[model samples]
Structures are given as structure tokens and as C-alpha cells.
Target: MSSVRSFVNLIRPSIFVHCEPIEDPCGPSATMADLN
Candidate 1:
């Protein structure tokens, strides 16, 4: 899932903004709501 990789990349930076990596390993759904 290339999209998943991209998603991870995009969200990786946000890990600090939200400070919730494990709880929301999926990252901020808001960023990829359309894909989900």
C-alpha cells in the first residue's frame, strides 16, 4: 500500500503536534479522511 507509506510519512511529522504515536499509529485521520 503505497498510500499507506505516504500516509506514514505525512503523519510522522505530526507525531509531535498530537504526541500520540502508539494510540493513533494511523496518524491524524483528518489528514487522510478522504482516503479512509
Candidate 2:
């Protein structure tokens, strides 16, 4: 179960990283071009 959680988090970060601009309205930092 712990391994599964770690795997989920690993994949999760990548998903969040790729979200970039689309998630911007939720936070000001989201508009930062450097995030892309």
C-alpha cells in the first residue's frame, strides 16, 4: 500500500508539473512563465 501511494505521488507530480498555465486562475504563481 505504501509503495502504491509513493507511485501515485510520483505520477502526480508530473501531472501537476504539466498542468502549468491551465491551473493559473487558482493561484497567482500559476501565471509565471518560468513555470512552463
Candidate 3:
């Protein structure tokens, strides 16, 4: 479960980068805060 979470964390940034302009209203920095 933790490994899966970590993998998701790794992949999320890439997706976030691509989708950020379209989907992320709060932006990557906010997402990073939530992740932590």
C-alpha cells in the first residue's frame, strides 16, 4: 500500500505538470503541500 502510494506520488507530479494549466486550480505548490 505504501509502495503504491509512493508510486502514485511519483506519477502525480508528471500528470500534474501536464494537466496543471487545464485541471489544477490550486496549482502544483498547493498540491505539494497536500501531499506532505
Q: lDDT of each structure?
A: 0.57, 0.54, 0.55
Which tens-of-lDDT digit does each residue in 1-36 have in candidate 1? 555656776979554332334356666685666865
Best by lDDT: 1
Estimated TM-score per prediction? 0.33, 0.33, 0.33
Tens digits of per-residue lDDT, candidate 2, 1-36, equal 555556767888554232223444567655556754
Worst 10 residues of 1 by lDDT: 13-22
Q: If both were scored by lDDT, which would come out higher, candidate 1 or candidate 3?
A: 1
Question: For every candidate structure, what is the RMSD over all alpha carbons to the true structure, in angstroms?
Answer: 10.4, 8.4, 11.0
